[model samples]
Target: MRATEVAMALGEPDIHKRVEVVRTRLKRLIDKGWLAEHQRGQFSIVEGLNGAALNGAAADH
Candidate 1:
């Protein structure tokens, strides 16, 4: 999702924080080979695979 989309979903008021949060998380996932960035502002999981994006964070539960 775009940063704006993330921000809206998260109700994050700061645009810069929204971009930073999304970019940082996406970059980490890409680096781990869990996701592939298709374009400058787009990403998806590697093909032929399915998994949750939850780390050991709040979403893990």
Candidate 2:
């Protein structure tokens, strides 16, 4: 997901979201291995931190 999507998931209103702030936080999470950037301006939960990982479905990724 992108920062804008993350903001929406967090319940931030469409007209009030601060994507820059969310992007900064996401970068920090990447630094800590909590998230992985899958593409430019996009991200995914790191394996082992989400259900797919727990179910062994993410091992091939």
Candidate 3:
């Protein structure tokens, strides 16, 4: 999501600050190779991870 969208979703009144934080965190993740930046302001998960495994801890009893 875009920084604006992230700020809105977070209900942060200071959009600029929130956007900066989002950008910083995204950059860190990207640098660590945890997320792939699709473009200047877009990102996607890298391949090879199992979605079911990732969600397994939240499974309903």
Candidate 4:
């Protein structure tokens, strides 16, 4: 999911904190090779990972 989408889904009391959580999660995913960034802030799912986006299904939160 996109960053904006994830932020919206998080719905935390503090918007900044929510965004931070999302960013941290994305970074971890990148380190794990589950996601590949297309640009500075854009990302897509890594190939051959069974549809696991770096952001994970929890972004639907």
Candidate 5:
């Protein structure tokens, strides 16, 4: 999801604050090699992180 989408998902009302939070999360994910930013404000999931366990748990929801 884009930053805006992520912000909305997190229930952020202010756009600027939303962007800030999304950017910070994205940067951290990138640093951990779990996510990559492709185009401007776009992101893609990268392999290597143990995200499967989280995904599996969420799948039951």
Candidate 6:
């Protein structure tokens, strides 16, 4: 999902700040090799991880 989509799903009160926070956090996950930004503003779990496992791994960060 895109940062804006995540922020909206989380129901953040501050739209602008929430998007920024989500984007930053997503970048962190990318740096940790947990996720890959395949396209601008789009992200997905890295190879070798299924959706269920990815959710657990993401929660760790």
TM-score of each: 0.58, 0.69, 0.60, 0.62, 0.63, 0.69
TM-score result, candidate 4 = 0.62
lDDT of 4 by residue, 12-47 (tens): 444677777887787787777777788877766776
Off by over 4 Å in 6: 50-61
- Candidate 4: give its CA RMSD in angstroms: 6.7
lDDT of 5 by residue, 1-61 (tens): 6877777777887578768888798878766567778888887777445455453332212
Candidate ranking (lDDT, best to worst):
6, 2, 5, 4, 1, 3
Scored by lDDT, the top model is 6
**Cα lDDT of model 2 by residue, 1-61, tens digit:** 9888998898776653487778888998777667899999898888776434434334434
Candidate 4, which segments miss by more than 4 Å at Cα?
10-14, 51-61
Per-candidate count of clashing residue pairs (backbone under 3 Å): 0, 0, 0, 0, 0, 0
Among all windows of 10 consecutive residues in model 2, the one with the lowest summed lDDT is: 51-60
lDDT of predicted model 4: 0.67
- Candidate 1 lDDT score at position 42: 76
Give Cα-based local distance difference scores for all models.
0.66, 0.75, 0.63, 0.67, 0.69, 0.78
Q: Which runs of model 5 end up more than 4 angstroms from their true locations? A: 47-61
lDDT score for residue 8 of model 1: 69
TM value for model 1: 0.58
Could you give candidate 3's per-residue lDDT for residues 38-60 as a string of tens digits?
88888665555343333332121
TM-score computed on alpha carbons, candidate 3: 0.60
- Give the C-alpha miss distance for residue 58 in model 3, angstroms: 20
- Score residue 61 of candidate 4 by CA lDDT: 21
